[model samples]
Target: MSTAIVALCFSGPTLADDVSPELVAFARTQAAHIAARTDVIEHIIAQNTNHAHLTLEEISRLDVHWRQQYGSQDSPLIHRLMNTPLSDALRSLQLRSSELITEIIIMDNRGLNVAQSSVTSDYWQGDEAKWQQTFLLGPGAEHVGELGRDESTGSIQIQVSRTVTDHNGHPIGAVTVGVAPLQF
Candidate 1:
């Protein structure tokens, strides 16, 4: 990727002045790597078909269900997400990052969680800027969210998101990597 795209990844309102350039670059690299993976692309394409017909109300219901079962051991939805090979891959990435990465989440074209390294506050991310600024903006777009405390990791972090595209360069989904800047 060009330096300009990397710079753009960290630009805009969500870019915090206190965040380290090295850390931002690291996150951007991770995002791009994840986006290029064939498994990630294939999984998202499959999910897009599964979720294509879901209405807004159905998404809200699923989100509500996810929130209600957030910490419970009996959540089928969470189980399905966490048990996937993709989720395992994400978790492995997070573990290998030596805590620089707090979490990783892969969302489908509709922004519903396809796989996640950890349980998120909600299932649907379509309404969030991470999804909008990346997937909605088209391929190669990125969004670095403002620094905040990640509930799962309990670390102050920023979520760096990038659009996932297929071989045709069509937007398939988005991946968000939560990085703890203090780890830099």
Candidate 2:
């Protein structure tokens, strides 16, 4: 991540550097649950055959909206953080494991978010890091990242993203999700 983007990626009230023990445990709890579902998210993207994959620019625009609406707020925290719409449907998929679920979303081949969980504000299409290595790392590959502090909850979170593919053996897009340590 460049210093410029990292600067832009963060917003709202800042969090303290001192991470609590509870938060550490929460992040750990979220890891496996998030890990198990990337492949499932990919399946969903694949099924949406009619959906056109978004370009990186489109995703960036959505991120801008997300930031303007949700990221700018500091109250009614849950509203800013919930991905229930996405997660509820995901639950029906009979996931291999239920660990820590924070957020989830589908991205087009061009790296725009199609639909997702816990999306407050969109920014730079999951950062430049994702765009660079997604192909080299393989489909459904996951990346662990610190998603900055949620102004409402004062909690820290780690996010993961997995690539998605269609039946034609083509890379269609990806599913990116996050899990905040329950300790928050």
Best-matching candidate per lDDT:
1
TM per candidate comes to 0.90, 0.49
Tens digits of per-residue lDDT for model 1, 115-150: 988889899999999999999999889998887666
Per-residue lDDT of candidate 2, residues 1-184 (tens digit): 2453344335432232333444445433443344345554454465345335655565566566656666445433324324344544544432322544545555555555444444435533546444335523565555545556644334445555555555554556655545444423
Poorly placed runs, candidate 2 (over 4 Å): 1-62, 71-99, 123-132, 135-140, 146-154, 182-184
What TM value does model 1 have? Answer: 0.90
Q: What value of lDDT does candidate 1 attain over all alpha carbons?
A: 0.87
Give lDDT per model, in order.
0.87, 0.47
Q: Which residue pairs come into collision in candidate 1?
A: none
